[model samples]
Target: MLFAGIKTDIAVDMEPQLIPLIDSLPSTVPFVGPEALERKRNRAFKARLGANESGFGPAPSVIAAIQSHAGEAWKYADPENFDLKHALAAHLGVAPTNIVVGEGVDTLLGLAVRQYVRESTPVVTSLGAYPTFNFHVAGFGGRLVTVPYGDDREDLEALLAAVKREQAPLVYLSNPDNPMGTWWAAAEIERFIDVLPKDTMLILDEAYGETAPADALPRIDVSRPNVLRMRTFSKAYGLAGMRCGYAVGAEKQILAFDKIRNHFGMNKLTQIAALAALKDQDYLKAVIARIIAGRERMVQIAAKNDLAAIPSATNFVTIDCGRDGSYALAVLNALIDRDVFVRKPMAPGLDRCIRVSVGLDEELDYFEQQLPQALAAVK
Candidate 1:
């Protein structure tokens, strides 16, 4: 009746066709959030130690700023993100021209991918690196070439080799890398950059920079056109929900994002929150200390359970389950069944571990108590 004379099946058949690349891609996403799991289980997690988000909520000043600016939500944010850009410029010792603010690193990655990737253009990344980046590459019709992690860290030399062999226009690396939570020294990273081909653009994701050691990050160099350093307030600043992030690079390279970036994509509240967070360096340092203490506690728990935690420079620790992938998965499921929300890498070499994030004292206490039971259940 809705279609009148036309059959329902005929109407369905007349629906618009998807582009070839989109149609070819499998219907899947990069990560399944804890809320989705909660919905499926009909309950909430007792301990939320997954997704690497800071359980130590944002600075009090940041919250005050958000509350103060709540009324401004009725209006659109400044499309240029002018004030936030200049604030970030002052903080990072770079000019406003070197910065491009976006909804988050994830959105910026998509924009970067679109800028360089055409149909079947090669892209290089670590095999078990950030899946969101891989998702962006696939969506933009780029061929992904991956090198495996070496010694639990991104093999910079191997990544360079793949970039050269594939002549990839774009490459991605997360310092203090995710899932495994390992990092390389700044000097070594600088050496890698020196050898990289000039034509290849590097997306240096430093989302965990604040939680990492002082020497872990390379000094900001806006002179390099090929490197884009992506940072987010989500990790240490506790603003993942706000979704504010920015990338710093050479002037021309940063400006390139304007061609395809969603001008008004950033939420107004996020700008207010990030600006306040930047102004509170004292709070940032205090949170970083707590994260370090939490990391140490996580390591001790793993040891107590006869498991080993990979040394972490990020806010999360990836615990080696000392077994095969299936065994590790069982441990992860056992934790989930106990209302402990945690995650694990799914890639072959990295799947033998489960990742846990730093949380409040009580949450970690819950994790500590339940982890032994989870292991017992798995065994």
Candidate 2:
């Protein structure tokens, strides 16, 4: 007898069981990386533009900082993220207590969901805004209520109505939205915030804020507990691979992250790189100019191809294919087959467009050359 009366024999088939919630969920990946597609096709893409990564890359100073800190990777990043938090606080005109830095906005979104979401809790979002937020909600078993877009833009009023009707504790909005690149003016966003229910929490994702017009972003105010504004280094700072993002809000709500967050999840190199990127505003401005120019070139290309390009505030442009969803999808697949990488929104109302990122000039040139051929193939 191994232990007095306890049976020593165990069933070999008895494995550790997943929690009911996790076991019930489907295995889903929110975004498929271009690398995976290349692997499946056994060929690399000629133009790598589907992922919305800034092909422009990180600032030179940020690169230098990462190289200088390479040897320090042996040490774990500061658990409190003290220096980066303070730097972000100074930049945003908020106290350190009002900031919480994380791996990226994606990770922070999960953390924020865990803070308020539980089994069957209501969460509200635009129908096709960002899939990762929906993934997080489903992982935590929060029931999602979606509001449809109004003219390719996130319908703020409808989202507000859903929040009230469902009494959702959490709602997400991406200004200068993803997949599609439309944005509302700052005044409209402020009006939405003013009317939002005090008890509901809003996750305002400003991942593309750097690429938007100055007036597109409202004044950053951390006074309200209901709003958590997310910003990332992935877009204009050209640090997508570095994976640094932060959320700013009232001190009390910011502090809640500490209860559930992985304290040392940040990489030392990422922290150094983010801090350095934040200091180089001149480089950022120059990159934004290039991004705007790229957007214009893409629009021109769309017009020349006889497709209509939606006005964009973000780094990507969504071009309408002048037909139904099937035709747009055929165009996208044709481009992919011809070695031009791009993506399209799959949600019903928004499915008639293909999204293209503002890649480097050469890549965009490759896309421009291949687009007509792809359209012909689809036709």
Predicted model with the maximum TM-score: 2
The residue-by-residue lDDT of candidate 1 on 79-196, one tens digit each, is: 9999999999999999999999999999999999999998899999998999999999999999999999998899999999999999999999999899799999999999989999
Scored by lDDT, the top model is 1
- Give the TM-scores of the predictions, in the order they appear: 0.97, 0.97
Model 1 misplaced stretches (Cα beyond 4 Å): 1-12
Q: Residue 360 CA error for candidate 1 (Å)?
A: 0.4
Residue 96 lDDT (model 2): 99
Candidate 1 weakest ten by summed lDDT: 6-15
Clashing pairs in 2: none
For candidate 1, the TM-score is 0.97
Residue pairs with backbone atoms closer than 3 Å in model 1 (clashes):
none
